[model samples]
Target: MTLELIDIAVQDSQSHPRLAGRVTGHVRAVLSEMLDGREQTHELSIPVWADIADGTSQSDIDLALMLKAAKIVARLKLSLQSPP
Candidate 1:
């Protein structure tokens, strides 16, 4: 489904530590796959959207993906820099 139709509803934690931990782990797993590594220290705030069948459209999703790749490349460059 298009991101426009995929409503990301934030659910409240019911004060259940176990459930919260599981959710967090799952989210990390998915993001980790996207980041090309098991660990990622970078922080990115991207609001993404995609075109739907409607007359209007949003290209945020593509922007977000591009940003993510750029972040990884930037961090890799920094890692390769010599000590000042």
Candidate 2:
């Protein structure tokens, strides 16, 4: 079945791993849903922001590590300190 092409993929030059991954996930999900079982011709390039993570063939990022770091920083900030 032939389908219509709508919207284009765009990439961000800026490299922010966490935010970029989240954005890429959303874009991929949308395209998958929109083009489900549809046949299309021509090449499509979706611009995804994958910082140095792209250096590796398999792009894998651990978001948990970022969260853990955040939590640790938060704890430090919350720790009772001498009143200034």
Instruction: Estimate TM-scores for all models.
Output: 0.32, 0.24
lDDT of 1 by residue, 1-84 (tens): 101111122122122244331211100101221233344443333322222233322243333334444454446556755587
Clash pairs detected, candidate 1 = 49-61
| Residue 72 shift from truth in candidate 2, angstroms | 0.0
What does each candidate score in C-alpha RMSD?
Answer: 14.4, 17.5
Task: Give the C-alpha lDDT of model 2.
Answer: 0.34
* Total clashes in model 2, counting residue pairs 3 or more apart in sequence or in different chains: 0
Q: By summed lDDT, which 10 consecutive residues of candidate 2 come out lowest?
A: 25-34
